[model samples]
Target chain A: MAVITVRQAISDALREEMERDENVFILGEEVGVWGGTYAVTRGFYDQFGEKRVRDTPIAESAIIGAAIGAAMTGLRPVAELMTINFAFSAMDHIVNEAPKLRYMFGGQFKVPMVIRAVGGGGRQLGATHSQTPDAVFAHFPGLKVVAPGTPEDAKGLLKAAIRSDDPVLFIEHATLYQWRGEVPEGDYVVPIGKSKVQRPGDAVTVVSYSKGLQLTMQAADALAKEGINIEVVDLRSLRPLDMDPVIESFKKTNRAVIVEEGWRSYGVGAEVAARLYEEAFDYIDAPIKRVAQKEVPLPYNRTLEQMALPQVADIIKAVKEVL
Target chain B: MKKEEYLELYRQMVLIRRTEERAAELYQQGKIGGFLHLYIGQEAVSTGLVAARQPQDRMITAYRDHGVAINVGLTAKEVMSELLGKATGMSKGKGGSMHMASVEKNFWGGHAIVGAHLPIAAGLALGDQYRGGDGVTICMFGDGATNIGYFHEGLNLSKVWDLPVLWVCENNQYGMGTAVERASAVSEIRQKAEGYGIPNERIEGMDVLEVKKAAEKALAYIREGNGPYFLEIMTYRFRGHSMGDPERYRESEEVDCWQKEDPIGVLHRWIVENKKATEEELKQIIADVEQEVEEAVEFAENSPEPAPEELFADIYAEEV
Candidate 1:
């Protein structure tokens, strides 16, 4: 195992996939000559020729639509949206076209593509740029939505996403890119739609994913210092959500707290809470607690932005409330 | 073109005309559900274009796709079954009037979104280009699609990458209820290709032979690796945009005027004038189309509904 940033893990996964499959190529604005906006693909342009690392114009529809088309013809195109905010521009292709092509055409075509989008609220990018809209993409049935919190999960899940036949939206949190964690080397693939218990305990169950999982882990550590053993479950994939671990943990602990960076209403927290109530109602010890961003278009001011976004303290408070 | 080819083109246009006419009737009888965009006056555009392409070349089109589906060799029965939402439909009744496709036939799809498939067409061409093949993607859309951002974006990317795509705009006068002049900056849709630095031409779409000749030249240019070529075929739809269209936008006189240049009528005259086929042979072809459509409707009515389990199937290729 090697400790690396989430950025490096994702970058390595992409490089390895492209090397393994000649059909795999990258296309997006500034993906080629600009070496990627966040420097995730810094040396990829020079390593792979222009044909594989294509630079596209600032047209989200074309980038995603073309990617879907290429994927239909047996090419694995990893299209990068400068940010998840830009996904709304190509929302028709992402949600309407790519997902529906195979089923609508009665399995005549397959969109074997990956849309890599950066999301989350931080860096004071304002309301439009800063959004954790993973739930919106997760709402669709045909598209697979994966948001990995740790470096290991990022590397493994990304490789799996690229190899999957369906269209997978691999969302990377904008703020979690530099966060470092241990990642396994050599062809490691963590299957999509599986949840793992990152930190096991018996006191209370804390379920989160992506940036929220990072915050939950910190809260778990803080609670541990005070002798409160809280269990943390990382939801790797949002669409085919593996509620088995979550339900089992809830059955054991009898108390649960769901954490997410998006809004509380109709968000990931709401979905998990509803599922828990419906599946494991007998295990309930208290009303399920949810820690999420305050309902507001994330403000521009650094102080206000951090205030609106969910933090480590918020997760801890939610856990303690459930306990 | 050979005499047989001309006769074949005439047969295709008549088949499309008859199929669409039956579809309109079925829709009125409440048998066919959803929006039905008939390709009555614009049959020559797709017929000619499909006739000019090789087996390897790909084709994609907008919501007005039943004609393109038949032009690419889909049986009238299959097209009607799809329209009737039967299990034997091209898409197994999953995609209704606007989503018929055959990968083996190289017909990409019957995409419903206005300008959405333009970029997908570019991607199909990009795939061929990446593999270093001579397959050109022929994308068909309406005049209204040219006004959308996807049109410009798809066109610009095709030129920048020098992908093999022939963008064919079947400039039927109205987009839904709005006229081309009211909705678009330039009424001449092919001129928009100039902004992307792609060579383009405007052709008379009412004449199938003319459309076939122009499409051949445009496709040849792309096949030769010169890059994407734009062909804007001037045409009109004799029927309303779709079933239940009030059509308050255009006058009856205008519809009648364009009706005089009906694509099928133009082809019938051209075949006789050029001595491609006798008048008796042409009339026999029309009678044959009538029989084909009658049988198609009977086949569609007899076809079964998809099984209850089909609803949950094919949503994802890989099971969760």
Candidate 2:
């Protein structure tokens, strides 16, 4: 095992997949010559050549639509949307087209494609640029939604997504690129929908994923120091949400807090809380608390943006409230 | 093309017309649900374009896709079954009028969104290009689709990558109720292709032979690695856009004028004038098509609805 940043882990996964499969190619705006807007594929152009590392026009519909087409034809394409905010431009293809093609066609077509999008807010990019709309994509049935919290999960889950014969929306948190964690050496893949117990504890259950997982982990550490141990469950995949670990952890703790970087309403927290109530209602000791972003358009101001975002303190507060 | 091929083209056009006519009746009877877009007059466009394609070449089109499905070798039974929403349908009853496709026949899909399939067509060509294959992707859409961003992006990418694709736009006068003059910046749809640096042409879609010839030239040009070519086939729909369309946009006189140039009628006249087939043979083809459509309706009616468990099936190729 080697410790690496989330960015490095993702880059490694993409490189390994490309090397392993000849049909795998990368396409998006600034993905080739400009070396990716996020630098996730910085050196891929030079290594893979122009045919595989394609630099597309600034058209999200074309980027995603073409990727879907390519996937339909048996080529595995990893399409990057510069940012998840820009995904709205190609929303029709992402939600209506990609997910519906296989099922609507009665299993005649398979979209073995991965759409890697950078999400979350903290750098003060404003309402249009910053968003954690993971739940929105997860709302669809056919498409698989995977968002990894740590470097290990990022590499493993991304590899699994590429190999799966389904369209996967692989969301990477914008602020967690530098977050470091240990990743296994080679050819390892974590299953897509299974939630993992990041920190085992019995006091209270904390449910989160993506950037929220980072904050929850920090909160868990802080609470542990104060003799309040909380269990952290990282939901690796949002769509095929594996509620087994969550329910199991919740049954043990009897109290729970759901944390997410998105809004409190109609968000991941809402779904998890509802499910927890439905499945493990007998174990409940208190009302499940939810720590999430303020239901407001993320502002450009740094302080205000941070205030809108769910922080480690917010997780701690929610966990304590549930306890 | 052989005399048999000409007769086959004529047979396919008549088959599409008869199938859609029966489908209209079924829709009225409440046997077929959702929207039913007929391809009564514009049969020559898809029939000709599909005939020009090699077996390896791919074809994709918009909602008025029954003609294309028939052209690409889908049986009248398959098309009618899909129309009736049966388990034996082309999309196994999932995709209705606008979603018939056969991977075995290299017909990618029957996409409903206006210009959405254009980029996907480019991607199909790109996949072929990446694999060093010479197969061309022929994507058909209506004139109104040219106004959408997907058309521009798909065309631009096809040229930039020099992908092998034939972008065929069936300029059927109006988009739903609005005419091309009102919906598009330029009425000549091929001019939009010029903006993307792709070679293009406008063709008459009333004559099947003419459409076939133009498609052959365009497909050859793309096959020779000359990049994408756009063909704007000027035609008119003989029926309303969909089953319940209140076509208040045009006059009966205009419709009559275009109806006089009906593609099936034009093909029938051409065959008789050119001595391609006998009057008896032409009559026999029409009779055959009517019988096929009748049998298809019976087959679809008798076919089972998809099993209840099928609702959750094929959502993903693998278990979630």
CA lDDT of every candidate: 0.93, 0.93
Q: List the residue pairs that clash in candidate 1.
A: none
**How large an RMSD does model 1 have?**
0.9
DockQ for model 2 equals 0.87
lDDT of 1 at B36: 94
True contacts kept of each: 0.78, 0.81
Error of 2 at A6 (Å): 0.6
Residue-level lDDT tens digits of model 2 in B161-249: 99999999999989898889999989998889889888999999999889999999999998998999999999999899999988888
Give the alpha carbon lDDT tens digit for every residue of A44-97 in model 1.
999998999999999999999999999999999999999999999999999999
DockQ of each: 0.85, 0.87
**Total clashing pairs for each candidate:** 0, 0
List candidate 2 segments past 4 Å from native.
none
Residue B37, model 2: lDDT of 93
Model 2: colliding residue pairs: none
